[model samples]
Target chain A: MIGDSVPQGDNEAAAREVASGPVIHIRNLRKEYTSVAGVIPVLHGLNIEVMPSEFVAIMGASGSGKSTLMNILGCLDIATSGSYLLNGHDVAVLDRDTLAHLRNDLIGFVFQGFNLLPRASLLDNVALPLVYSKVSREEREARANEMLGKVGLAKYRDSQPNQISGGQQQRVAIARALVNRPQLLLADEPTGNLDSHTGNEIMNLFKELNERDGITIVLITHEVEVAAYAHRLVRLADGHIVYDGSSHEGAMSKNPTEYSAAVHSTS
Target chain B: MIGAMLNEAWVSMWANRLRTILTMLGMVIGVSAVIIMQAVGQGAQQEVQESIESMGSNLLMVLPGSSTSGGGVRMGAGALSTLTTNDAEAIEELPTVAGAAPSVSDVAQVIYGARNWSTQITGTTPSYFSVRNWDFAAGAPFTDTDLRSVTRVAILGKTVVDNLFGDENPVGKIIRIKNSPYVVLGVLSAKGQSLMGRDQDDAILIPITTVQRKLASNQVAGSVRFIMVQVKSAEAMPKAEQDIVDLLRQRHRIREGAENDFTVRNLTAMANTAAETTAVMSLMLGIIASISLLVGGIGIMNIMLVSVTERTREIGIRMAIGARSRDILLQFLLEAIIISIFGCLIGVILGIGGALAASGMTGIRVVITISSILLAFTVAAAVGVFFGWYPARQAARLRPIDALRFQ
Candidate 1:
């Protein structure tokens, strides 16, 4: 860990006792899509940082580049320009396989679809990340069971994804993500497909994980209700962040336009 | 990590058990076909080799002549008495000529205790047994003293002994040939059948003088049928043939401008032609086996490609969850290899059963070797891996974002 290399603002120090260095450091990050039609630019000149254990949400409309940013943060894709440093390792310098290990070791991802391998049991799905990390079966099972117990799905470890409820599937996916004990959890619309009640439960589990285990979480969503679950919110419009501040203001009202206009003017 | 990949593959394959077994059919047939054909081909090859050995090695047969032309009248070969006992003796004296046996034969009714059978009766010296590499099932061959004294001793072949004596041993038994009593000296061990399908084991052998004077007395003085000459080694066969021909020509008082009165044929060469034909058949079996394997490989490739396409999203999920590209490749390839190996196991069992059944039904000697089983296994596995590689690579190359976005 990069100890004390972070330049602390007095207000930040006052906010939380300068938790080791920032878990994520980004500078001028940009992404582009190339097709036969033409080159399409998505993210343009983005800079952000997330401290360890910080609960942040990246909110955006479709094609607003929040998913692209989340992808970069999860090491699924690299920025076309600019640089990213996750846990003090330069993201751009590592090769594809090394970046995969980085993803396995440092970050965990939760997708909107809850992509658990359907043929695998919940226990196997939860232990899958440890397989890539080459963890022994007994140890992987123990850690996976512990994570499942933490997510309140230990008894359903033998169930298949289809056999479980949508909320239980999401919980299994969360257990899989946390099974590797990654420092940063990047979730892309973690509750996008769920009913409101199940979505709130998943959000509460994320909240509890962040608060109790000090796990850094960066979530992507368009819904204000989901974004409100995080302590901090970063809103993207067109390819730039329009707001980066308290989630309370971002989700102060259920009306989408009130939060959007306020974020546009306030940031 | 590899264990995990295998586990994942097993789970996936188990979920699609019917598809897995159906896909294995191609491989099973491929491996089994090769094994069966090889068993049959090698069986035929072994039969030919054994027949060749039984016929004796390094042999050259000096027939009487090549379609005799005498007094402006063409006649079949051996119509003239071109070979004699003296010629056989002279050929045997040559450095490369290991042994020589001149024979006179005739068909006659043989009888013992009211049991009668018609069989070919041959007369030759004890050297004929050596020249033919003949072994006795019982008793012994007549010696030089029997040949000199013109004793009526006979060695019965398996078929002859079986007809004459039934379950009784024929050694030291007396049977009448042409109403003359001849003692049974020994029984020749069975040689099954010749390449020409002749029952070589159906004849009886006696001394040349005894047979010529008593049973088949129409021949001219000192004249005989073809001379069977055995050479010292295979490499000396050509030279031995030349020596036999030159000695015969000189002994016949034939002039330099005259055509020779005898013809020499390389018996081993003729046998080798049969062997070469068998080899070609074995080669054909090998080619067909390889073609089946190739077809099986294509089947594997096709199924793997379909599976990859159907499970593209699964691949994407694994990639997003931190599985490497090599991990995906290894999983697919491992699945193919395991299926191929299992298929080979089943095919081997089936092939062995098929071979035994074929042997039991057809009565041809069937040979199933470990090397044959190993060959089928190694080649089929290689084909599976070779064909499985491209599809696995296709799965591995899909970009995570694009793959994850696949509907």
Candidate 2:
């Protein structure tokens, strides 16, 4: 049921050989939106493979299709013409309910808005996933508390999202994401609403979680400094990858003016 | 899972306290109206039944009904009296008959001291009091000797004495009835108002022989107005009524297929008719009150829709955290149910209070039944579930992408 079941280019073998196997596999992914005007192609023939326990960042300017790619990766949307296998399950073949289960059990998402229920306590927000998983209330609370402690917000477990700072709320979101112990964590601009220092702190927490707990993370951001925290960087230009390499080399190649020109020429 | 949903529902409801309370007010008023209206209808029914019962149980009346025509001038019932004192005696001798009294009545001006009031003057034997379950409030009732002697003694009803005497004792005082002087023998107790809204105590009673001989002697001689018969028991009313009809027909020599001159009326049948009318009235009132509950349910639906729209982002966040559509539906539905349950509780208390307050103000006995409370509570809960379904479904059907992006 993995995307590898479909014949892909030679890059599949190279990606599989990097580790035991890749946690996220997408080949020739395409997405098109239809409105009253006509069909607008957003993502076109893009390929991305993420290995287990790796911290990867996707960087692109506006209209470069990075958000669309992140939505597909998070199982919130489906590819129009492509194969996406999330932890060995083919995304396109799953129904809506099964896709929800896949997202719940295998993937956790963090948003730039830090999408936590405004009236819920930090503990309740973190324990929500386990409630859907049918976990006992005591165990759910225990695990939620443990995750909060990991993020150093255990004392603020009873605090509501509005009562906390944006950085603290983002941290609570991180705790909630990790509470289920999902294999893949998807964050779309996790630090977009934070100051530079708080953004650095959030990135460092991600780095620590990746190194200490071996949790795979895929983050999407347009800021180079934010992307710098990732071990690997994948840059998108007009719905196609322009560079996929080490963060330092990718940063060196990411010239804003040149990238915008290249993006315009492609569209 | 349900417990968790309920917790979430309660939390969400508490988040907007004013809106929840305002929404619940409709249900509260609706439930209370239902109970108060039902009580009023039931109380009216009871009042009618009691008034009929006070007239006396197992009682029957024989009336002269056959009209007479001479030269195309038809005389109505009692224009020519077909009922006589002998018919009353014959009815009393029947096996099921308890007692009978021959009665005649006329509207006359009564005079005592400087006061004069126009009231009904009923002339009957002493047995009329027992037959109608009436008792003397002061002095004593006139006996058979008074009837045989054609004594000018009268029994005054409470209202008649109050109007003519103004709280003064009337027993043994001389009064004028239709210009004929008579002594008040005793005062009858108050019987309140009849079901027809007429005053029952605005009358006086004297011997039938006196009325026939002195007052209405020119109209019909030795004839009576009607016969009041009391049966031994409630079970004997029908048999006694039939016996009276048969004996009267035979005595009048009413041949086969010939119309009888007398009519028999059973108090028991009249009582049943009154009871049936009351039952139907209460049922109708209950149905009308329930419509207000339906309107209250619609109010719930309206507020729930607004809540679902306001909490779109919250729903998306929960869905992102792995909450299914059913989970979202259940949460909102539970919130509605909690509101309705609390509303119903407060409504029940207020309804009973309102009923008692009405009873106090109107001097009517309002009955609050357990079945009504249960039915009202159950309907309230059902309304919550029914109205909550559509809005909850709308919330559940929201796409996570759209809801999360909602402003």
Candidate 3:
């Protein structure tokens, strides 16, 4: 009812009226893959805007253009024909170096694979982003330790990634993602490789960080339970946004029983 | 930024310790080979010059006719007595000529009491001692008056003194030469060996008057074997040689374009020839050794290429974390420089040790020059950069997405 009451232009105009615009603003975003079979369009005129301090989960099945959308949002890939402005900077027009700087200064990424440098200790792995920021060694170590403490991996500061369990490795990755104090956290299936219990813990951690620290989080997942943790739910189908509303309303209206535990806990 | 990159490079090196050491071995051998070869060559050249100088740098031997044989008899240079006492006197008057000695040598049996020895007998004046730079071990040389009066006073060389006198005082003793008794005047100082490997100390010195009047009176009067002329300085040798030739030609009344029946032997020329040969030899050896340095550079390039390919994932992670292309390039380039510098330092120590060892084994002195060490060090660093560039570029050019996906 709220989506039907307002026109798309009026919604975008409202979003732009805020003191600081949305963290992510895209209009008519499209991406096509050029292979031996010519061009295959993945995302077709997809547009989404996430305001500051909001937790949103993008849910989609395979070939639903969710991953491609995440990549474009993360500045790792460019859109074919569209406008994506991240934090008031037009990402499509930015050069490679500027994109790298934007990523370093504002964006943090956590992958499902728990991409921690294997040889680096837990502390070093977290502190790596600051090395590029030119932070002093002592300060980097202190900040990294503080972040590790937040993730409850303070005792494993010197332990290598391989020496830790899968759940602990994910915690270390989370610590690394927050060590730079990035405003935008982009997680592509952050707990895809973890067990169900560990996945619940990670989701709770993400919920706590978004609620307490006011860090905007954009997570991509196919799991209905994972989507239930976010306040806003966005579902992609056939490279187009089919649903965007409160997770509680979406869960109850679409498939309530399957994500009932996630819905009840979050509500 | 540099410090951070260096730290990272250091970490990488330690992570692959065996590979680092193996890569450095090639540089070490290359640098040490260059250093040792240069040291040994320079040392040999120095030894040759020193031995030549010891033989006397300012000496010139004016012989009869040319040294080469025209008729196949090979009678040896200075066989004809074209030189005379008057010719020696004329040469001594020249401003560039310091001194001149006219003398003749013969192998003869000299007996002193029960000890008898066959030795070379050179009969000349006291000026021969000063001209030859000879010193006395005991007593004094025969005076000029001894030559004028044909006195049979002799000076015994160290070898002759040891042979005939058996460490006894040879001065004021009498020795018989050609059955003629000559009183021993003094002993000449020990001269180990001549340039020709002759035993210079196993000889005797006496008055020229005694040589012609008493020893070889049957030959032409005042006939000299050769004239030993000492130039005032090495710089004056060419002028003195020319002056002596002009003067000798006029004195001999030889016509223009005719053979003057004399030759002047320049000892410095001989020294220069020997020096040039050694220098050229060392240069060739240095070039041969430098090939290994090139090979070492190639080895570095090879290792760097492998490193770039093997660490592709690591490179991607760093790029994703915010490392610029330049940062990745700097990390690898700095790593190569560190390895090369480490190899250079170790190679210098090894090279000096090798040179010393070679010297001990061969009994040849090796001179290590600072220039060679610096050159080898600079080359080692350059080899790292020259060879590391292509691989570092390859690593830097890798796309983050592609590298991350690379297994």
Candidate 4:
């Protein structure tokens, strides 16, 4: 029933219609988990579209299935029902290995915990994703070094993750995510584990990467400050998008139901 | 991709050096036990084989009436002597018979100047040397004329020479046997031991005529205790044994309806039985050692399972980045194989060292064969693949989302 709603107004759709194609397009996506209690549904026919080079932030409370959507967008998990098209290819039909290839070739992931291998050197950690891509050693090192420099951590490449500060470790994870030069970057609570200062610094870096590299980014965060960095904001409430509009407008609106003004294009 | 997996596995294992070594201990002990047992078993078999070969080929022992023939030639004491040299001479003329020598043995004191030694004195014709594959160290053996004329000539074995002459050449030297002076004909070469662990070079050889007439005079009218027969080939052994039995029976004037007065025993069959026994022993040791290897493999499997559980986050991160199930499987399997290969190398060294130590400390012969080492390595590889597979599969089967969510 909720799939019929287009939360954004006609003007926003008219603006996005000029882009050649959508990088991510999902229709009636539903996911379920079986437990001893019964089948617990996580997503209820959620639908969304993200265009190329678009920076979209997803906001929700803990159980609103924002993380589940991020997983599906990154190709890490499949929807139990619905169609997800990544790079114009249906992800539901792709096998596990092929999905892995799709993720490797097109998507990058950043997590709240940094997710860097603690024992590996910063350089090695950054080069890890390229290893799965079967990149040559010399090429992997060259590309990893370039990404580290881009993240402003070039001098500490040899240092281990545990030896670095939390902010620096997250930057290293960003470098790793970008090392594959993936077309889409997916970040889940990228600044959730940091202080306000370090978190702002990271958000600025993401903004710079999105603008300068023209890389499409889908970020999931509940904080208003973190979501404000993205141009477009998508708010999920009970497994459906309650607000889809400008990030500034979404952050200023205190209550989700108030997004009706943006949805209906009314005062 | 596989190379990267191998590098990842090496790095992971090296990150936990102490744990890796501890987990490898079981494999080390198991492989070492297998190697040591195989070495000792093969060593024993080789020693037995050498002794069996040294005892000559296609041999048969002919015993007199009312005597039982065991694996070796048993000299009956106080039994009536029924066979003579004439019977041996007649048997040698048969088509399958190569040569035959009638022999008599007695333990007597031998004196060379002031040095005196009590040793076994075997009396037989010169044909005994060929039939028993005996060789001389110094001079020639006594000829046929010496046996017919009852000449006092003797051939001393290595042990007798060492005891009576102290490294001197005993040939042409006069030695007294039971107070009768006899000229030493030659010194026999060293023959290590028999299948029954008897020293083959500890006695003396003298003419049968001389021993029967003067030194041991226990026999009645030129009769001897036993005859040694050598067949032309291994295939002729059974027929030659039968021929010798019939010839001896006819020579002793036994009727067709009556039981034979002498028994012919095939020495080759006895040696074969000894060989088979040692082979069986070697196989048994190998089997027992493999059980310990199995235990070691189980230890590897257990430790790998724990490692997979502990490294769930690492697996998730790799999978999120883009590692396939096959890549994860290769990574864990490579880790297991590396541990076991290193364990096997250390085990081989320890096993060889143990075999050498056992040989040095004790008098038992130990042989370390290359085939045994190869067999151990093959088994170790098999164990690695066998035990490492299950844990690797588990690691590969983990869902990326669940693993990433895991604490």
- The C-alpha local distance difference test score for the whole of candidate 1 amounts to 0.86
What does fnat come to for each candidate? Answer: 0.63, 0.49, 0.30, 0.61
- Residue by residue across A1-267, what tens digits does model 4's lDDT show? 212221222323422443468889987888888899999988887667888899999999999999999999988888999898776668877777776766766789999999999888899899998888788899988999999999899999999999988999999999999888777899999999999999999999999999998889999999999999999998887776788889988876757554544333321
Give candidate 1 misplaced runs (Cα > 4 Å).
A1-19, A252-267, B67-73
lDDT of 4 by residue, B1-407 (tens): 66666777788888989888987887888788888888788888988888877777889988776644676564453255778889888988999988999999999999998999989999998889998888888999999999889999999999999999996878889999899899998999888888888888889999998888988765687888898899999999988988887777777788879766677788889999999999999889889999988998998899899999999998999899988888888889999999888888888898888878887988667778888888888898789888999999999999888888889
Q: CA lDDT of B287 in candidate 1? A: 88
Q: Each predicted complex: what DockQ?
A: 0.63, 0.48, 0.39, 0.59
- The digit string of per-residue lDDT tens for model 1 on A1-267 reads 332332322323422443477889988888999989999999987878899999999988899998888888888788999889887767788766766776776778898999989999999999998888788989999999999999999999998999999889999999999988778898889899899999999999999999999999999998988998899988788897777778998666433343434334423
Candidate 4's C-alpha runs over 4 A off are: A1-20, A258-267, B67-78
Superior by TM-score: candidate 2 or candidate 3: 3
TM-score of chain B of each: 0.95, 0.84, 0.80, 0.93
Q: In candidate 3, what are the lDDT values of residues A1-267, reduced to their tens digit?
A: 111122222323433444276899988888999999999999888667889999999988889999989888887788999888886677777766666666666678888888898877899899998887778899999999999999999999999999988989999988988888877889999989999899999999999999999989999998889989999988777787777778877754553233323222322
Each model's lDDT comes to 0.86, 0.85, 0.84, 0.85
lDDT of 4 at B138: 92
Candidate 3 regions off by >4 Å? A1-19, A30-45, A61-65, A235-267, B66-81, B101-226, B233-237
The Cα error of candidate 4 at residue B133, in Å, is 1.4
Per-model clash counts, in order, read 0, 0, 1, 0
Tens-digit lDDT string for candidate 3 (B96-163): 99989988878889999998999999978777888777878899988878978889898988999999
